[model samples]
Target chain A: MKADTRSGTGDPMDGFDTTIHAPNRLRICALLDTAGEAEFAVVQEQLDVSASVLSKHVTVLMEAGYVEQRKAVRNTRQRVWLRLTPGGRQAYQAHLAALRAIVGP
Target chain B: METDEAIRPTPQQARATLAELERVQASTAALSATPWPRWFATVLTLYIAAIPPVYGGMTASTQWLLPKSAWSTVLVLATAGYLALFAFAAATWRKKTGVALRLDVLPKRATLPLAIGLPALLIGAVVAFRSTGQPAWLFAASGIGAAVSIAFHRAFVRLHRKTA
Candidate 1:
């Protein structure tokens, strides 16, 4: 991940965690942030990624305490729902702000 | 393999990323714009439009025919029915939209102006009815208000989707 080293603007780059800087990870965060929570399959379908690939990114997010998962039985089938933690939401918002800052006025 | 660390975005790339993110958000929002809610909102508006007359008719028509307590019970039941419908519609909406009720953009857009204008218009109608003893005017005003609100909602969705 590229560190924000621009010294003068002081746009709070500290909130931009490297964990969420990945392109796919950033997209996942963006989706969850807006949807609030979504079924795992729904997220995968929306992102158009393989199950394994989605799981890998989700695992990274889970490890970082940025995401949580719940399992439920829907139509007699187990379904996983994914949502961002409050901390995750804060971090994502801050990261978007950092991105905006990087893009500049 | 190009890992995330190897794929840092330049300023232009960052702009593209943000644009994509915004597009994603917009698409998610659009998913929630299904017709069920629109129809429900229209019905709810019409239901609200009917409330005054329904309650007034219950009391007026039943004044000599039934006990006062019975009137209260019927009014309570009618009000409860409306509340139950609202709750059912809201719950169904949450399920179908896969987003919380607060994130409902159409209602949010329609509500702000409606919230401000609705009370004033309703109160004005009430004042007019009380002073003039004409009940039809109140129903006419509320019915028109409800229709306008539905029209405004459709217009907002149409414009919003066009922009999106």
Candidate 2:
């Protein structure tokens, strides 16, 4: 799909790139992007955040319909598996576009 | 296809958006300076396999000549050294791979091999640990260690075979 050339202020950056922002969120997305799918604990460990903090942020994005979190059992243990939803991927790309715009070609 | 309602940012908005792009690119670059896996299993293979023999030697060696205190101290020191080396190797591998050491994050699909593996390893460890200073324990440990590596090898192959 083609990208919208608009920004939060309804102005065209002309060549804006979209990228997901927020330090922890960006890190989480980066890990997920590379790792394919990872357990919640893996993301938490990589981000070095406590469970509650991750849960909070994850839930926020999750509620926004950005990230996908699934429940599964591994090694007979319950695991919270995470991946980026298509919507989330789009949002990330859009954010990345915005970031690219900020850098100006 | 282009949607009619797709928003078009004003030049100023586009310029501001460019700033976002800059920040993310830099952040991602900093986040992953190197690509690494959760567990760097390569370097661990050495002491990991060597453990059977080392532990076996400690158990079976004829200690009648040396003082009990000195032998025990030596054994402890050797084990400590092994651990230190393991740590060093792990660190180096991490630096090289840009991946963190994460054993728990192993693929859920790999549980079968792991399930098949843990028993084999446990039996080997039990046999080795239970041996009454017998050479047989070393052999048992060796066999178990081999089987475990084979199982782990299968897992690694499965993971590595996936196309990027």
Candidate achieving the largest lDDT: 1
Judged by lDDT against the true structure, how good is candidate 1? 0.71
DockQ of each: 0.39, 0.07
Native contacts kept (model 1): 0.39
Q: Write the per-residue lDDT of candidate 1 for residues B67-104, one digit (tens) a residue.
A: 65665676687678778887888777655655445434
- List the pairs of residues colliding in candidate 1: none
Candidate 2 displacement at residue B11 in angstroms = 31
Query: Per-residue lDDT tens digits of candidate 2, residues A1-105?
Result: 123454454433332222244456756665665544566876776667999998887887777677887786645978787878877766666555544444455
TM-scores computed on chain B for all candidates: 0.70, 0.45
Candidate 2 C-alpha lDDT tens digits along B1-164: 12122454555765554444454433333333332333434333443555555554444445533554655566577668767866876566443433344443345666666666655664566355545655565556666665665556555554444321
- Candidate 2 deviant stretches above 4 angstroms: A1-105, B1-43, B52-78, B109-134, B150-154, B161-163
Cα deviation of B2 in candidate 2 (Å)? 26
Q: Docking category for candidate 2?
A: incorrect
The whole-model lDDT of each prediction reads: 0.71, 0.55
